[model samples]
Target: MSQTNPMPNSNETPTPMAMMQMISSRWVSQPLYVAAELGMNEAFMGKLVDLEMPVIAGGRERTETEYRPLLGAAGFELTNIVPTQTPLSVIESVPV
Candidate 1:
């Protein structure tokens, strides 16, 4: 006689990385949905150049000199960074 099992095999369980990816995908999309609903998408329509301002993470201000190397290491060209009136603040021109 043969017995049948109702439970799924252990191989069907999701791995840690797969679970994280699922969560991260949802987390990233929520902001994009909000931005579209707030008319941000329409405002940027037909704009050839867009400016990206540096974010102050953890309430700490980072100077351009300090962030340049880090951005360079991340494969971004540092020569594209433009200085603004505010100290330690830089804006980058991104082509849309």
Candidate 2:
């Protein structure tokens, strides 16, 4: 009897780093979207805070100041981080 399926054409195996990059890329995307939606990218400019802000309006209690730095670093490995000692910010928000 003959097998209906044969081995894959490529004799080479994918690199561990490459596979990790692919998986990490997909996982990181959601945080970027959330950060953009939350406007953490703008944090570098001024005192922007919603220390009591929810992930969404009428949603769970969340702090943008705390989470923003974390999200940015997690997904992109940010070159800089705002001072952790700075209290929650409340600068005039530019409408998003």
Question: All models: lDDT?
Answer: 0.39, 0.37
Candidate 2 accuracy as lDDT: 0.37
Candidate 2: tens digits of C-alpha lDDT, residues 68-90: 55444434333333333344322
Give model 2's clash tally: 2
Please, what are the lDDT tens digits per residue for candidate 1 over residues 1-96?
342332236467655444334334443232211111234353464231223232223234466687666555433444555544323234452111
lDDT (0-100) at residue 76 of candidate 1?
41
Please, what's the RMSD in Å of model 2? Answer: 15.6
| Residue 6's lDDT in candidate 1 | 24
Instruction: Find the candidate with the highest lDDT and give its number.
Output: 1
Worst 10 residues of 2 by lDDT: 87-96
- What's each prediction's TM-score? 0.29, 0.20
* Weakest 10 consecutive residues of candidate 1 by summed lDDT: 28-37
**Using TM-score as the measure, which candidate wins?**
1
Candidate 1 at 84: error in angstroms? 4.3
